[model samples]
Target: MSAMTSAAPPAGARRGYPLIAAAPPLIAAVVTAAVSAAVWSRLPDRVATHVGGTGEPDGFAHPAVLVTVSVLLLAGWGAGGAWLAGTARVPARALYCGALAPAVLLGYLSPALLLANAAADQAADVRFPMWHLAVAAGAALAAAALALVLPTRPAPEGERGDGAAPRTSTLGLRPGERVVWQRTVHSWLLTALQGAMVIAAVLIAAVGGDTGAWIVLLGGAVILALTTRVRVSAGEFGLALRPALLGVPRLGVPLDRIAAAEVRPTSPLKDLGGWGYRITAGRRGFAVRSGDGLWLELTDGKQYVVVVDDARTAAALLNDLIARRSAHSEG
Candidate 1:
């Protein structure tokens, strides 16, 4: 096992996380239901439910059916958020903002759907205004902004002062010798989230006949591609991380650019905010799960971190390689 999974996070690391994350979607569902009720009389017998690429209604359903589906979807989304919160693996604020942004976007769309149908003589005549998409995007942005400003618990504190110093001469590489260290890191939380997306996609397909199901499946695929596992490689080339599922989307820090490398304990949620290819303030890196991570102090005045098993060896190897490169540059 990697050092990344050796230790558990602090108790109550996830306290109040579920409620805060789930609130937005549940509230959005209620608001959407209220709007549907207010315009119930104005809505045509058949309401425009789905639109095509042309921004025109391509599918219709009874108002009751439409509202029921919308409410159910929102409820399910909220449930998923709550479920993710229980893992205690991601930052609370991240979950809150993520939930709010999507809830607000969908909320705007639901009402726009009703208003568009209400103004039409019949469902077939309803024109799904393209501008409504812009409004939804703006509303989502506003909701995300609100999430940032709203009072919330501070990030969980990490165990500090456990950092290991760079072993610059540990390896003592021989002339013409080549050395490399590699490890693969995985995240159970990410795997579970992808599984949930797959299940949700199946449920949506069963009810909605593959209309919105593909989008959910696509999202799952994206998560799988990016967060399934990461391959960490340290050699004369310095440090590199590549998604196990894809070849092109990779990160690398050249040997010349890295000033030093060491091992340090980290909190994925607290330190880096959340996992999987993150950039925050002065430091940036991939953190699938966290414990002892390889911390790099770059020449450009920035830091990089990646959680991996046996990070000491990787760091030591990187430090040794950096020393060798520096010595060769001077000689």
Candidate 2:
């Protein structure tokens, strides 16, 4: 196939693309970290425990601890968000939520943990676990809200692709076209698994009448809802996924928003908090629904990932896109 060249960005606006694009993840990370830090620092000096007298007071900021933990949390959230923006075969919503979840968790949990520890001398109270639950609830609500906020960049003047809204015709997947198919299949598989989980969860809720089962069901529902929307489009745009309760979700992206693309098998367990759209540079990247796939590094410093049916094929397609884009730009 002939490599095509990309047209240059319009005068005065070229430089802005990089900056604008980078803002999403960077902002998400910074904001999340700040919020988390603020929450962490608010624990009660002496939390009562079941053991006995309350232990020594706890301070949220140990300066060093605050910086270290905040940095770590920020990095995790940023990587996760960018990864989703770049690859996930879905929309930025999922990734945004992904980032927000950890931030909220860190904010509330870290502090709560300290409080729990502080109160430990008094007794083996439920402070720690209860705090964890509180953190989880708050995070869930916050994530839900933020994920719905949606990240959007201007679609280039003449740009369009699979990630675009919708069409009257087929998805435009043509034979012999330079494209990635594995990710689609993998995403579909994940969708199927999520569907099964949701079904099992529903069954458990119905047959078992257990709140735990209901909670599990809800989780599966979230996954199922997330999995179905991932996809690559006829347009040259990269993978995108939009979550449920979010609009007419689909696997989509704006062609111009893409910054970079690459391929690498991840230490699913070690690098990411364990697969399913993991993100972090040193230890993370967006990965959705498991397995090896393609990695897209957006100008936003976020890694959007797609689980490819064939990694080799996905790499070839990405190389083609980069070449085409570069060529088009230089033309």
Candidate 3:
């Protein structure tokens, strides 16, 4: 489909988008409140507010303060998320997931914090079990995975290949003319590494009787599975990178913002600081390994690169789309 065809809705029409997209965060807030209330009486008058590197509580605060702060932070987070969801050019699902992931984290942390401090003596320094940290990290990861897999509106109608045959273009394409190139990239090394980590985590948890460790391993496995294989696509909409499992473009560059694009060799370590979804000094990239990929220079002077095979075709199509968009703007 042509990039322009899926242009963002008007501002007036988008006012409600925030409310709808804010549902997850709002639900999270409600869950937080309920959990907090349920544990209120059991919580210590002063709860552990800060933990040192050694996993011991170094500071304390009133339970009321913690709950208030959590609520305020959640509100601010939700508002910011709503704004981003309404404004960004990427898919709403991506925005929703991004926003919801943190909400889920906060939701889990609030109650865990209260429960952890409930048994602490008022006279002694509270020492939280180190395993709780692992649990928090694991919960966050699980939340993120859940967000990624959560269903959203299906891809817009006609986004799939039309009955028309594919055409090639170098300079530009006619209005309604479309070009698409897609390739799936896989990394066996990363997969193996993740598998080893998962195995180690599971073994450790089994030996130590740590549920948190098991959760962390499960979360790690989910993340590894989602990211091990990526599908890169370029069409009228510029460029997109999506995990094969979710089939939703988590990263995208709109054609309107693309100044130029080309296929070029890349170094994941040198150019992008190694690995998937990297942001270096001046460039952002969704890279998996080091190889040829589509590189884009945006109108805002930022650069984006994604490592994928058949990048030559994707780059050509992208440049052509940008040219067409520019010419259309001029005319």
Clashes of 3: 0
Candidate 2 per-residue C-alpha lDDT over 266-318 given as tens digits, one digit per residue, 9 for 90 to 100 = 32343355555454663333444333445555666555555443443444555
| Number of the predicted model whose lDDT against the real structure is largest | 1
Better of 2 and 3 by TM-score: 3
Quantify all predictions' global Cα lDDT against the true fold.
0.74, 0.45, 0.66
**Top TM-score hit:** 1
RMSD of each: 8.8, 16.9, 16.8
- In model 2, the Cα lDDT at residue 247 comes to 35
Q: Which stretches of candidate 3 lie over 4 Å from their true place?
A: 1-176, 201-210
TM-score per prediction, in order, is: 0.54, 0.34, 0.45
> What are the clashing pairs of model 3?
none
Model 1, residue 297: distance off in Å is 0.5
Cand. 2 Cα-lDDT: 0.45
Q: Which stretches of candidate 2 lie over 4 Å from their true place?
A: 1-182, 185-229, 232-235, 242-260, 278-291, 300-302
Model 1 ranges with Cα > 4 A deviation: 1-158, 161-169, 207-210
C-alpha RMSD of candidate 2: 16.9
Per-residue lDDT value at 193 in model 3:
49
